[model samples]
Target: MLTIQFLCPLPNGLHARPAWELKEQCSQWQSEVTFINHRQNAKADAKSSLALIGTG
Candidate 1:
């Protein structure tokens, strides 16, 4: 598994717009993509905007 770690630069964190954008981008990939929120102990499917926003 590949692991990537980065701080969110958005002032509002992973809100709807960014989450949707992320989902859109991830949808183009064939591999499974996931977003992990260490602080919240949350994991979300990168192809779903709702799941991404739920990470917060």
Candidate 2:
């Protein structure tokens, strides 16, 4: 499994467009991936757009 933390300084945080793009990229990889937001205590599947948005 591989995990990464991406800190976004953008005012919008991780919105639809960015989340979709990230999900698309993650989908192409073979490894298992997850994103966890320490501040929010939220978790997201790196390959899923809906899950990413739900994390926010």
Candidate 3:
């Protein structure tokens, strides 16, 4: 598994609009994508809208 750390450049962070965009972007990837918020110690499936919202 490849683990990458990226800083969110979003001004308002990952809100609904951006999350949906991310969901679309993740669809293009063949590999499984997951987002981990270490600060909150929470994780979410990058393909899941509900899951991503939980991280917010």
Candidate 4:
């Protein structure tokens, strides 16, 4: 597994549009992807926009 950590660049943080876009992009990959919000102690499946949004 590959792990990447970066700060969110959005002024409002991860919202619906970006989360949906992210989910779309991740769908092209066969590997499982995860999004983690260290500050919030939240984890989300990258293929699910709702899960990504909840990570905020």
Writing each residue's lDDT as its tens digit, candidate 4 over 28-56 gives 99999999887788999999999999877
| Candidate 2 residue-wise lDDT, 17-55, digit = tens | 988998898899888788776668888788998888877
Model 3 alpha-carbon drift over 4 Å, by segment = 10-12
| Weakest lDDT window of 10 consecutive positions for candidate 1 | 4-13
Model 4, CA-based lDDT: 0.88
The digit string of per-residue lDDT tens for model 3 on 12-31 reads 45888878888888878999
Native-to-model Cα distance after best TM-score fit, residue 22 in candidate 3, in Å:
0.7
Q: Local distance difference test, per candidate?
A: 0.88, 0.79, 0.82, 0.88
lDDT-superior candidate, 2 or 3: 3
lDDT score for residue 20 of model 4 = 95
List where candidate 4 sits over 4 angstroms from the true fold: none
- Report how far residue 24 has shifted in candidate 3, in Å: 0.5
- Displacement of residue 46 (Cα, Å) in model 3 is 0.3
Give model 1's TM-score versus the native structure: 0.86
Position 24, candidate 1: lDDT? 94
List the lowest-lDDT window of 10 residues for candidate 2.
1-10
